[model samples]
Target chain A: MNRILRLFAVTLIAVVLVEVGYAIPSFSRKYKTSCSTCHYAAPMLNGFGKAFKNNGYRYPAGTDPEMTKEEPVSLGSEGYKKVWPEAIWPSDIPGTSPLSIWGIGRINYAAMNDVKWEFEFPHEVEILYAGTIGENFSFFGELEFENEDNQNEIMYPFALQYDWSPGLHIRAGMVHADPTPNHLKLTRNHYNIASFRSRNRWRFRDEQIGLEVWGAGNGSGERGGYTYRAGVVNGQGINDMNKEKDIYGKVTYKIGGLGETGGTAGAESQTSEFFIDNSVTVGGFFYKGTASRAGFNDEDFTIFGGDVDYWYDRFIVNGALMFMNSGMPGIPERKSMVYYLQGNHVIYPWLIGLIRYEWEDADTDQDAVKPVNAFIPGVTVMARANVKLVLEFKMFLDDVNKKNDTFTLQMNFGL
Target chain B: MNRIKIVVSISLLFLLSQPLFAGDIKGKVKAKGVKHSGDAVVYIEKIDGKTFDVPKDHAKMDQKNLTFIPHVLPVLAGTTVDYLNSDEVLHNVFSPETCVDKFNLGTWPKGQIRSYTFKKSGCIPVMLCNVHPEMEAYVIVLETPYHGVTAKDGTYEIKDVLPGKYELKIWHEKLKGASVVVEVPEHGEVVVNFDIKR
Candidate 1:
């Protein structure tokens, strides 16, 4: 244990050194704006940040004319005008390569009857590429490294999106299909209810290669509106070995405040006496698929869920509930339920407080693994626009009425 | 000698009062296809071979509740504007328009003020906050000082105008209105009504 602790310390020091010694400016350079323009922190997106992403990594409000001018550097009068493509008429490319890197490090201590501590330097590292090809076409891709397992994985979000209008968009590629509450939260400590082990019984995969159509009404401000997404994907995970495909769809309606109109670009300014913008979104999702297992030929799975997100000023509340039913060849039908509730409030521009409760009942028979319940409270601090620090305390009530707890601290840096 | 002095004082007082007798342009704007008709700037177009003096007092626009107060502001060319922040958050003011040289005032905290002088006339520049993308305001710089913004009821009155024929124009953030030639009488008020549309 002492040797492991020493090793962990060395790795943590190395990661911190790298972060402080090197800096790679990314999207901020492309837009000629600071990271704070879109992000509440390194990865957590504010309202404007979400709109920018919905607009295919382009400026949601509109592009500045001066930022769009491109000057060609020529090697010769008629040959090799420029190696790097400049901003063309409708296309604004700040650099030839639209790529960025994000890295995270973590230190975790767990006490499950016995106390244990571990350190992970570069808990995860991601190479992100995103930009607009033209006025309406955009693309995003990411390659990630998970250091705990010492394995490299490709996040299959390589997708192309075309904006038909502010209210309509079509995209096709690998995408996240899980309708869990934590899927959209920007945090390293994921809700245990959506963990891989839990998902095995639920038969819900996080990412799958698929084609999707999604859109929002009133993309401009945080006003009342609606958004929808529907897609079809391979039932299996990244690599599909089965012939069956999964079908999924989700729809959300927003009330109060400015709707998701895609007009966050300063085109419209609110004049109401109220200083804070408020919005609430209620959504539902349905998924049907067939999961192939080694012992069992195939199991038919159906899952349905609902979620709600509310925002007022700097406070936010999010909750989701999912119910699953599955059938196998010889076994009776199995039913399960999983749900979670989370809330976050911004105490300051650089500080936020969060609380979450998660529960899962894997089997209806009560004989299966005892129902698990977990409570988590955390705080996130922004040292800078691209630097974030999070500390969380988690308490778990496992089956058999056993109590376990964990404490974790994570640091993330992105450009 | 006392009689001559008294006569001189009376003459000067009469001369100053004569300018106050100039006609006033009073009007109401009817905006179509929009929520309210407030913040509409009504001004007189440039007079032939005429130039107005820049005012010594600066106009003010405040940042309150993550918004630029008084969504629309009209000012005479060569006037300086004071941008004040009343909210607890930091705010930035900038213009992407070339007419104002595309000036960007860096972020400032609450209770602080930044000033900028607009030199070019006949240009409407949109002001934006880099920190808050949804915060927006407009500054309409004109050559004449005879301008008034409409109230919530769409009423506006521009006073102390010299009796003459001039082009009157109205500007709205999201609407368009036609410029009309109006002759201000030597005395009393001339009522001009405008129908603006999106």
Candidate 2:
């Protein structure tokens, strides 16, 4: 090899070493508690994870940095907080209720040969807050920017959260119907699954405009182990609504010893014990699109699915299967199903290994189609209660795919 | 006539000596640094080697408004705690571990009462409603009756503490362990303030 080629190879090797070396400890410290605590599995965000995201990823950072090397500085730290205390501030106003900041960053690198390498640097930073002036009403706004498309263009997840009663809450926001197990994009990065545009041009706004009603069961044995959420969305994505929009709804039911719903390990998460130790969710959505659109041809579409999640101590296994059939002709009258068999073991009190085999296939590959088979294996290390680092390896099996194998390294700390 | 007189005399002597040794050991147990509106039980245990007995009528736990009325209730071994759920919804009560009586009462609807008799008391625990995972109540069963729950302002005043060399102990739901200990002089009201550490 010539000198230039040798230099390129050396640089590539150095980057890979850093990435792999950093990833080793990253996997060892991501889920220090238990897998059942934060996720049903990969791409499956449990109740606690949702709260952490909604709160802009802020969580109580206990004392552990002194003992562990991967413990990232928290929002309370002098260096990080001083530079960005309002992690996702709107830049509109200052000095109002102490700005709250949320951020997620992804660093990816892949090497195919001695002279070729692919790299992507994308991150999302947001600032948001929710305030209430009176009973039954609250307003929330989240401004976010991603590096892939626009440099500083903002995407807002704005909405109003209403408390209808002790058992029910309603939210009307420009929000996605929460990317469940089926909706998640299979990718190496931990922050995001995948984008429809990455594979196809006319794919946007999987979010629909709608209202969601959610409730927790009262302690009665008959109703205790269930959490129900249902809503009617635009049947498209978010932010863009057309006249052909349809109503969508989803209901999730979890049955287990109390506190299991929150996916945490103490009284802070669950309030009761388990007489009926199990949890299951079944949901279906329908959309009526009569207007003419560019991507969608017909006037109607419907999606139906059911998710079953069970938690037995340190082991939690869950699977979700959804079917979407578009009324538009020449759309292959699609039936798409994505399912995974996941197992999580608490290696120790603070170390966790989560392995999952995922498969996503559709009836037709018309536009923006994803791979049919994906073998994903991931490990996370929860060095402490508040700090986590994750390392994931994703292998795609297909001839028309480049960058067939990918590795992801991520570190997250809240509060 | 002689046998009856002997039995009656023995019974009278046993009753006469009970008050002297036991001495109505009445005192209130209090916890500090809690702000939520709830109650907790305070308990006392006598160290007779490894054996102890909790008074039957001394321990009680209550649930109201879908929350444990007293968040903490300390009790002794072999004690019967009245687990009352006063909320409009039904409550199923059980503890997965650390107690012998792990029974679920199904659904006890509004304005109803159910009771559980704790036979083996080593730190008997109580949890509520498998459905309402946010509704939690704790009953810490010890081996003595020398415990009391804290008041609204985090102040606990244990009254009628028998004047003796007694080891005073305190506990809280969030507190890690016993707050502190003190010695009580005979017929003396000792003011012990516990600054519970998180």
Candidate 3:
């Protein structure tokens, strides 16, 4: 019965994709522009796209009304700005609905020691809301539904942000704790350093409910500059387990390529935003938090990580190293070291090839056979500006997962 | 024999003396799904045996206040266009359309000018600035000089076109209009109207 159900779902999704016609609309429909303006592929932003995101979902020049095709409905008139304290400040809402629907579906075939080729669909259907409320206020939200263990699992993450300038902003709600540029990766899998959860369930990539101040400064493109973010949160991902708060901070310095806000006038790429990025960005991050359980021994952990990204024309490569320990006050038996190196090249405007090597040493074990060591290779094909397909194979080299290698073919799109 | 030759010469002169027929074509285009009906290029497509002289003076397009002045420009083939940057900041121009050779004009400060000649007819290229992705314009290269730009009221007129059966076409960046077959008579006006849709 489970096998039949999976096959039915795959056929149904394929039919729906064909009937929906070309493109999955989002910002493109609102601004009356093509998806290629921001995305090298769906969800993987390019140089100008980074600037757009950094500027709080509006154009980098700070909320240009002319940038949008439909004029937003004004809550009050522009005259209210001149009157100031005499009247309340006015704002505008999107002329069209801000909500956008997109989804990801994967058909996987796995090979393991005890099982012949098994089938599991890694599925996600999401509704995303993102836009600027006015000149200064912006918000982003994602309501995601996933299929896990033949059950529907749901999660919603959101952020409300305020823009003060091109260089500074403040935000609240679920915000990322690291500055790893995970959105730039072409693969479907998360970086090992970003997702490797300690026994306490502490993860670096998880979004935490928190307040944060972040900024990107210096319009230096080929010349170097920096962007930094810091926040204080309850430490837990979705629910609070204790009254103590967790704090995390990250900073990155870009040595070349397009800057956080813009780029040099003549030096910028005229052909493609993705391929022409030539830069080296080095970053460091840290998170300190404590885990508590009912009638159990408590542990305080501190995680330190460093990463470097190199972009040379059509090629991009990244390396991350992380160390986490609960021995801050001399507690033993809890420590881990992890690292991953990934590289990708844009073979064509519609194709990309990538490979990643991940290694982890958990529980401070010096075992001759490492349990978590693997290599991943993948290719992404963008059939349209909004529809993408990725095929990946994860091969484990350790004694534990040597016979549990997996391969995945995934389709991702957004409207 | 001398008289016969003179008569033949007189008959040939009479045949050559017949005047070429010419007339004006006027029309109105109702464009749907846009604020204005103007900016649509209405022209006669290439007539197999016809050729018109290219205008010697160059057409001008200006970048001022980070906006492209005259968002749409229609020019005859073999005509040169002078792109002028009138803003204080630097700006560059490039088009991705392969029909136009995919040319790029490097960035320059205010008061500088660059030139490109439209050698291919029927090439419509969307012009863009690398520095300002929001800035855009279009250059429509036509094969014949006989064309007219629609007014705010969607009315247009092509004057002194050689009288013949021709295809009168309408082009809008976002709207599709039907082409009409027009038969023009000597010194007379032919009206061809269109209703373009989304």
- Those runs of model 2 whose alpha carbons end farther than 4 Å from true positions after fitting are A1-102, A106-122, A128-141, A149-153, A161-172, A175-206, A210-277, A286-371, A380-388, B1-54, B62-74, B80-198
Write candidate 2's Cα lDDT for A1-415 as tens digits: 6977765555432221111000111112322222223333333444433322222222211111221223332323334435664563112111124234444455453445453333333455556454432334445565555454222334555567665543466778743453342213222332111122111121122333468776544233432234456666554445333554545555555443432122222222222222123334333333223323556554444556565656555555655555545455654455455455555555653465766666555444454666555566777765443445567777666545446676667554432
Candidate 3 per-residue C-alpha lDDT over A210-315 given as tens digits, one digit per residue, 9 for 90 to 100: 8988988644532446778899987764456677788889888888766666534444233444345577889999888876655555568888888998888788
lDDT of 1 by residue, A1-415 (tens): 9977766655543321111111223666564555665565556555555555655555444542233323212323322335334533334344456678878788888776353787878787777777666567777666655564453333424778887765677887754465652225655566543452322333443445677788777533435567778888875544554688888888888776544544422223322111133678799998888777555567788878899888787778888888778777777777778888998887876788999988878776657556788778899988876788899888786755445688889988877
Per-model lDDT: 0.69, 0.46, 0.75
TM-score for chain A as predicted in candidate 3: 0.88
Select the stronger candidate by TM-score from 1 and 2: 1
Ranking of predictions according to DockQ: 3, 2, 1
Error of 2 at A410 (Å): 2.7
Residue lDDT tens for model 2, B84-174: 6554323557676546556665545445566676665556465755544455777776665566666665555555444456555555666
Docking class of 3: incorrect
Off by over 4 Å in 1: A1-25, A61-94, A113-115, A150-157, A180-183, A196-205, A219-222, A264-277, A365-368, A399-401, B1-198
Deviation in Å, model 3, residue A29 alpha carbon? 2.6
